[model samples]
Target: MVDDSLYILEKMRDLNLSVSTQAYNSILYNFRETDEMWDVYKAIESKNEHTYSTVVDGLCRQQKLEDAVSFLRDSEWKDTGPSVVSFNSIMSAYCKLGFVDTAKSFLCTVLKCGLVPSVHSHNILINGLCLAGSIGEALELAGDMSKHGVEPDTVTYNILAKGFHLLGMIKWVWEVIQQMLDKGLTPDVITYTILLCGHCQLGNIDKGLRLLKDMLSRGFELNSVIPCSVMLSGLCKTGRIEEAFSLFYRMKANGVRPDIVAYSIVIHGLCRLGELDLAIWLYDEMCSKRILPNSRTHGAMLLGLCRKGMLLEARALLNSLISTGCTLDIILYNIVIDGYAKSGCIEEALELFRGVIESGITPNVATFNSLIHGYCKTQNIAEARKVLDVIKLYKLVPSVVSYTTLMNAYANCGDTEKVDELRREMKANGISPTNFTYSVIIKGLCIGRKLEKYNQVLRDMASEGVTPDQITYNTVIQHLCRAKDLFRAFELFEEMKSRNLEPTPATYDILINGLCFYGYLKDAERFLCSLRERDVSLSKFAYTTVIKAHCVKGDPEMAVKLFLQVLDRGFDVSVRDYSAVINRLCRRELAKEAKFFFCLMLSRGVSPDLDICRVMIKSSDVLGWTIKAGLLP
Candidate 1:
């Protein structure tokens, strides 16, 4: 029988005898992927009416559809062609290759020859459109098939399920499954598996498992481990850890062996929950079971141990992994370094960082950021500088976070010069500073004065549409108080309020202090009460500022009562706080009260600086209470 089929196929080859255009099509289609392309054409040229259609089919399959179309549309081809099987094969070829329009044109020629499209015809084209992701078009073609009186079998629904699965269309997956049922087509394991994969890929893994269970109840055996293993992973990611374990235990009960992927997933879940020991134990269990851990499983174990500050265990796992012929990937090394740095082990992090570079593995942005932050926290900004240089040297584009980190590092160290330098570098690199970036710099500026330069930054911020946030407004408000720009500070405060940005107690402290520094006690008092009424609590600084406001107004007794109020509140009033009142106190011959607060600051944790001590001694001397104040100190 096989010999007869081969001889007939070859005779269709030699004779070039196509019965009809369809017969010619079959010949053409057969030659598409074979080396006998010219033989198919030769068979066509022979003009044997018996084999013309076979030759044409071979041509179409050989991707000579256009040539076959041209030849068949010739006056001679219509008169002599091959069989329907030949043409059907050609049409199926065109559809499979995503040349549906070309296939349609060929079908029109077939209809012109008075031949109708078969069920095979509909299946091939519908499947092609499904593969091409033209779901709507594929469905429409299926409808057309129905109109042509062609019935789609279970294979048709299965193809559509595969299409939806490939496209990650979860919602429509069950709809297509329901269609198979509505059409009285029995659902098979392939059908359920396809839909389950779709649901899981679209993050609806639980739904997928539910449908799988339904399939099982309907006699779909739980024989395949891959699908259940993948579902176990999805359950773990969504924090259904116990359910994932239950599924794990159930899989074993059902005789589905857990593979590398399954073990990796369960270990990964444990790692996410900070259960490193459990993850390690599972690794040992995999080894005992003789189920060799894959690279992913090994990397998970390493990272999990690293997360728990178990670098020794991570290193040991890494060594064992190398013995398994899986070289440590860059991520495995980076996770270890990040763990070391976060655990405040800078020396270990740098050692690993250098080791990574030496191993010829380029460190990514996260690696550099960890080192930079660690250096900054340890006050070794110079080491941080070297890291920045290395980052630039590697041509690694520093992200906004990297630039922001450098900005923060300088600001914390009170290095405005470096802050300005880094800002220019940031712009040169086309990295815009976020509002958080501006906030850090302004915070540093608040402790020191650079009103002119600071105003420029604010203007730049406004122009950039990076509208300052509450911290931004609070920062500038706090600093403007130091410079005593009461009217301008008041205007800025109102601007914050008008924007529906309720000022914090820090905001009121700055504004009230600024108002009082310039002798606007009434404005200072108004802000104080406003701060209190808003339930935005006050600080010792706010009390100190109000007390100074009164002391500057020649009411030293009122200042003394406010000072006691500050101590009662447990807010540490700094030497600077007392000196604000004393500076005014000394000028008013109230050296007695000034010296009293100066001694009060030392008794508290607020250390009096050399300058504050000098100021107090000088003031006491002029008031003839110099010996008393010095003795008190």
Candidate 2:
């Protein structure tokens, strides 16, 4: 269309017909960022203020800031300087490009040229300052607006209120509101929405409710939908799902229809709280109302399904959305592919990955990470390494997670050499090892029995300011305990406490078992008592370990006493725990005592294993005691 208009204008010029400056300005305004606009401007023999302003705006729209400034100061405007609109165009362009300082310098140029800055002139700079997190400077600029004889308007106060709101400065927001009221400026819906959002973000939900009531008393309907959506998000974030639903109904009861944002907020909240059934019900209700769900709505739903490991349903939903002409992003595909990969459906994950590439969506590091994790879970290290190579093919820098995952897989398979090579590659690529990466390295060193290298890695970890977390400590402690290095294990345990890393029951269990294995029965018992004192609830298996240790030390009486004590203390004994004691008693030549304990195991609904049965049968035959048939069963 623009080409046809320009061609007609050229023909008219050739025929000697007059072409007005306004016609040329119109043509210039419609032209895109092309050199043709410049050609047309140069053809205008006589230029007016509108002609200059049009070209200035066109240049700024094309992002040619230097050329636009040059044209403004051209000698043609010697009699009358450039207009404030032209300066605003340049300032807006500069601000949008994050050159706020340069944009502010132009304000002084506007005044030096004897042109009074308009309200818009200061508001643009104030907004830029606020966006740059320079709220202090923004307030100063607003204060100077009245001094410049440009009376601050409602839009100006609205911008100030929004700036404070965005920064979460809720307390200062009230001061801005008071200033607006003192200036006799009535707060509009936008101002109230900003205030409501501010209070909601600060977790002052009750205050936000009162503000809503105040809006109602002032005849303000909840038609904006943004304030209502803010309230829904606030309620959901605070885990008040029931109240969010009430507000959804209230919005409808008051004849204020909820938009897709409101519905999506509630749905996301429900999904987050593991209330997927209710989320689906609300989703269906929304669809019944013919309010098409947007990408956010679909994302929330897909995430909920993925969290519950419902990969099949999630993929079907994705296909349905695609069939409806929805242009899904890579994030949505990543969620589904990750869900399939983690669920051991690697083939499905790869198939979806191909679909993403075919659709021209670029795969990111997270997409490949999921595939690597999937192959690692299936013990397919060779294929997992191939996935890492594919990441480089996509021109994306592999992340720490990518390398650490594959490294851990190889380390678990006792291939420490491969783990070291990957670590070197990571360093060559400028990637730092996280705590998890160090943990994998420690495990590989333990598997290879390289004690000197293991000690050096720990020293390097500390020097690099990477504190050992619970997983790191547990890995080292387990390896030490296995090697009968209890002294070092205890030292690391105390270090974990000093670092505020609480030892889990698994950690205590490992220590207790280690002591028992080294014939330190009294020390194991002391530790067990300490656990009870600390109120750490160890599992029944921990108690069974102690009992088995006592029996192995040729103390059948002690084992029986400890078993009863654990049973009395409300720990459910397992088959192995009972077998440990009964077999020991029979080996001690106490056939009658072993049979009595067997009866007790049955009374407690614990079945004896085949080993215990064979021991009891052999003891009964040697003593000429007939075994009860029903008892054996």
Per-prediction TM-score: 0.42, 0.56
Model 1 RMSD vs true structure: 16.5
TM-score of decoy 1: 0.42
Q: Report the lDDT tens digits of candidate 2 across residue range 272-327.
A: 78789999999999999998988889988998898888888999999998788756
Model 2: runs farther than 4 Å from truth?
Answer: 1-275, 278-293, 482-487, 503-633
Model 1 segments more than 4 A misplaced: 1-212, 323-328, 345-633
- Write one digit per residue (lDDT tens) for candidate 1, span 98-130: 787776666666567677777777777778788
Cα-lDDT of candidate 1: 0.74
Candidate 2 pairs with clashing backbones = none
